[model samples]
Target: MPITRRSAMTLPSLLAAPALAQPTRPIRMLMGFPPGGPTDFVGRLTANGLQDQIGQTIVFENRPGANSVLAAEAVARAAADGHTLLFASNSLAMNASAYARLPYDPTTSFAPIAMVATSPNVLWCGTSQPWHSLDQLVAAAKAQPGTLGYASTGNGGNGHFGGETLRQALGIDISHIPYRGTAPALLDVIAGRVPLMMQTMVGAIGPYRENQLRPLVVFGPNRAPELPDVPTLKELGHEVPDSGVWFGVLAPAGTPPPFVMRVSHALQAMLEKPESRAQLASQASVPAYLGPDDFAARIRTDVTNWADVARRAGIRPE
Candidate 1:
């Protein structure tokens, strides 16, 4: 039997019971990015918290390749005994559309446990550019279409998706300059090689604070606390899609409901702690806790949304 939202919501109470079965084997939390990245930081944070609650060692495994497709597929095909888990991010959702055929279904390959946190992407411009606000940037782009270029981590990544969505919504022409990763792309933006970029706050905050990059807007419901003065895309009068990056935990599809509930319960408790939230803040993320059902729904929505964006933008697998 699969765990439902109703039963999973009682995980905290369930954990209060003295006689709970703990995992005999070590738990593995696998992610796509290498260590030192934001995803890795959040994964380890959650894993540590889980280890404390579950009374078992949790190992973090990084399998960096193809924007987490490799890690996600590995977990999808792993034993569904709840010992192996995936620390999923928006890359999984974007890959659903970006790739022509994935080894596993992004929506169905794994069972969602809970969403750990979300970090909004920031639309930034180089100080060399004169556009101070998103409105000014749009106006400039409209005046000289395709002259303004934005850099992203790569084709079909969240940064790419954010830039594409903004292009379509505002009906402007801006050239996309995809780089190997966010670091190189951000460096170019700061060096004035690229005029703008829609990058994650975690990756861009340091440069922005150092006066190297200027943030115009963020892609979320509200402004980022780090950039409280900046506005969101919606506030700028644009119906841009919410393309922020979110991190979540998932187990193999056939994992037993009780086992799934146990992990989810542990995560829910950990997220409620102040220290956990502080740790997330250090990673430039905020707790966006969603139970299994809601997390599943979010994945389904993202898969659909990104697929549509890719189809309309004519983005294809590499």
Candidate 2:
């Protein structure tokens, strides 16, 4: 059966697993992005905060490759011990359609632990662009249907989906320009080589402040607190679901539920801290905690939604 929004995962089944001894050594969490990016920074910060609640050292290992597929595969093949976990992002779901095949089944290969935080994507353009707002840019694209292109960190990413969502909404044709990573894609947008792009609030903050980019609209359900001046797509009645980037935890499919619960509780506890909330603010994110059951449901929804986007956009890996 296909993994629908209803059947993607079940927390109760994982909870039925036999409880196992917790690891005495440090826990190792793996992420797929290179160091010095927003994902790495958010992952490390959350890990540090959660470390206190768990009373165990959590070591991070970067396995940067194929938009985190390399590290995700590593965790899926690791022992089902709770000590080895995957700190994945929204790409976990997007990769389902982004790539033709992945070593691990995103829906079945991992136990959804917790969804920690999420931030909106800021639709931005270069300072040199003539349009000052999303409507204006949409008009420009309408005038020259296939000429406008939007840059994104990679194919089958939030940018790809978000950009495609806008295209579908307006009935326009805009090309997707995929770069190896955010840095290069963003650099091109700044140089006006690409007229537009969607970046997470965390990654867009610095450049937006320096006036290297102009944020026209936020693609989240609500306006980002960090960019209150920029209106959200919802505010304009675009009727699209939130396509923001999310950070979450995952474990091997058979990992003991009690251990997963422990980490999930620790993460929920971290959100209660003012310092943790403030720290997340610096990352241009806000805590949106969801325990195992809810997190599984969220993954189900995103998997279903992004897959639709991939189908509509005809996304295929190179």
Candidate 3:
């Protein structure tokens, strides 16, 4: 059955369901991005926590291609036996609208286990720019219209969605410059090739602290502890969609409820640990756990929200 908000849940127990034996082989968790990036760091942190709780080795393999569509499709087709999983970011939802047709449904193709953490995307600009704040940048864009542009990791990534949403809400005319990776895209922003870039906290924190990039506003539920001085979109009096990148796990659909719950409870226990939260804090992410039901609902809602934004913004699927 598809995981829903109505799905029954309980505290994790090692022996809660002994009828289902743990997989004898190492569990494979697939993601779209290659190792050494922010996603890999988060995945490694999670693997360290889940390995001990689940008593099984987990391997995160990189299947990078087409904004993780390739990886998601693989997970959707894998055996629904809880042995294979998708370690996804918020891009999972955006993928629905980013593409014309996906082989699997973003929400229903798999069973959501839990959301491990969320990293807010901040608006970054070079110090050379005249706009010192998000409001000033908006005003400048309004005055110049198409003269300004923003860069993102790619066409359908969170940065694209964020930039477009900001344009739509504030009525600005900034073009989007997509790059294959954050390193290149960020370099452009720092070089003044692009005036603004909505970047993940994890990816932008280093440059920000080095005084290479200036953060104007944050796109998240609440202000991040690291950037306490920065104002969130909510604080800025703009009701933007929840487009921040979140890290989570999901099992292919048809995986037994017991198997699904097993992973969910393990994630809950992991996130509940102080050390785990500390690790996330180091990465510019915070613990934001939502069990199977809520995780499913969140993915569903995000997919809907991104699609609506794309429709309103006339963002055609690639």
Return the top candidate by TM-score.
3
User: Which of 1 and 2 is ahead in lDDT?
Assistant: 1
The digit string of per-residue lDDT tens for model 2 on 1-318 reads 122343224423332334463566899999999999999988998889878766678999999999899999999999998779999998898888888889998888999988889989878999999988888998898899899999988788888889888888778889988888888888999999999997888888778878899989999788999777889888888877567899999999998777887677667767778898898898788888887888888888888988887777777655
**lDDT scores in order:** 0.85, 0.84, 0.86
Q: Which of the predicted structures, 2 or 3, would earn the higher lDDT when compared with the native?
A: 3
lDDT of 1: 0.85
Residue-level lDDT of model 3, residues 127-230, one tens digit each, is: 77888888889889888989999999988888999998888878889999989999999898898878889899988878888888998998867987888898
> Please, what is the TM-score per model?
0.94, 0.91, 0.94
Using TM-score as the yardstick, the better of models 1 and 3 is 3
- Per-residue lDDT, model 3, residue 112, is 91
Of the two candidates 1 and 2, the one with more favorable TM-score, higher being better, is: 1
Candidate 1 residue lDDT tens string, 59-154: 999999998999998999998876899998889889988888899998888999888788999889888889888889888988898898999998
**Lowest-sum lDDT 10-residue window in model 1:** 14-23
Off by over 4 Å in 1: 1-13, 16-21
CA shift of 218, model 3, Å: 1.1
- lDDT of model 1 at position 7: 60
Instruction: List all candidate RMSDs to the true structure.
Output: 3.2, 5.7, 3.4
Candidate 2 Cα misplacement greater than 4 A, ranges:
1-21
Model 1 earns a TM-score of 0.94
Q: What is residue 44's positional error in candidate 1, in angstroms?
A: 1.1
